[model samples]
Target: MSAYVSVLPQKIPRQIAGSKSLASMLPTMLSTGVITLVATAVMRLLWLGFSNDFFGAWMEAWLTTWPIAFPVAYMLRPMLNHVSRSMSQPVVPIALPVRQGLMVSDIPHAAAEATRIAGLQVKSLSASRY
Candidate 1:
């Protein structure tokens, strides 16, 4: 019996060198790549409807936009993450007095009164349950 030879290479060269920094950037790189790919294709389609040149135009646009998008997205990722975290948390509503017929001097008193009224309302609500 003749021995079978595999066509595939035994060792594949690493495309990207793995490191701590690269690991940190991997998520941003992947997300930016996917977002830019879809956005560029969609925008190109919208601007110039399906044609024989559509694929070429879309590829060109994606190539141009991705370089710019990746750096901007990487830089803004921290701030955006912070904003997203802040937005996702539960928000506590503060009672504020309506501005109608209220003077600057009465602002403090009005706020205090609003808080007092709010506390009373809460107490009443809890009391009603019993």
Candidate 2:
């Protein structure tokens, strides 16, 4: 009987062997490649209709668009990420007047005041619902 032992590396490299900057760009490159390929194929199909030459046309369009898409996606990724992060954040509550015939901006304050007058602590809008 023969026994075989398999050994794994102590530490795996974070990236493949190549330029460090290229490694950082892998996500953007891959995403852009997929997006451009799908978009070009769809657009080509819509514009020219599916036919005998569809595959060739789609390939040409994808090849042309991918180069342009990659650079644009790489440059815009940071700004897009920032915008997405800001949009996903919870909105902060703002103070407004607590009075009758209040403006739209004062609805939350009026709601709070109504609850206060009713002897209920204003934990949140839902907390003070009638």
Candidate 3:
């Protein structure tokens, strides 16, 4: 109805200006998950349909090896977008942890100092260490 159309813009602006919205991102995430699931399912069904030992072995190997492809595609997407935007090549994202020694115990003081330095109000810090 006209009421829904009129209220939609107030809900979602044309430009979020570097902000992310769950409403917009959720569909993308869902589609990605669904595509991954469906592709795997279809490939599996096709592989299972073959009765020959050689083809069955091949299909089994293919299904087992398929997980490695997703990480490559996921890593490439940002790079491809940047490549399209400008001449800069995509940088590889390392899946390493940031710092080994820092944990939740170290967070309170650093967070408090950071808040103080940033001129933000300091609140009580509560933490539990195992």
Would you list the C-alpha lDDT of every candidate in the order shown?
0.85, 0.87, 0.62
**Each model's TM-score, in the order given?**
0.54, 0.59, 0.30
Q: For model 3, how does the per-residue alpha-carbon lDDT over 92-111 read when each residue is reduced to its tens digit? A: 56896557687788888898
Please identify model 1 stretches exceeding 4 Å from their true place: 1-17, 92-130
Please give me the total number of clashing residue pairs in predicted model 2.
0
lDDT of 1 by residue, 48-93 (tens): 9999999999999989988899889889989999999999998656
**Residue-level lDDT for 99 in candidate 3:** 70
Ranking by TM-score: 2, 1, 3
lDDT of prediction 1 = 0.85
TM-score of 3: 0.30
Every model: Cα RMSD to truth: 16.5, 12.4, 21.1
On TM-score, the candidate that comes out on top is 2
Model 2 spans > 4 angstroms off: 1-12, 96-130
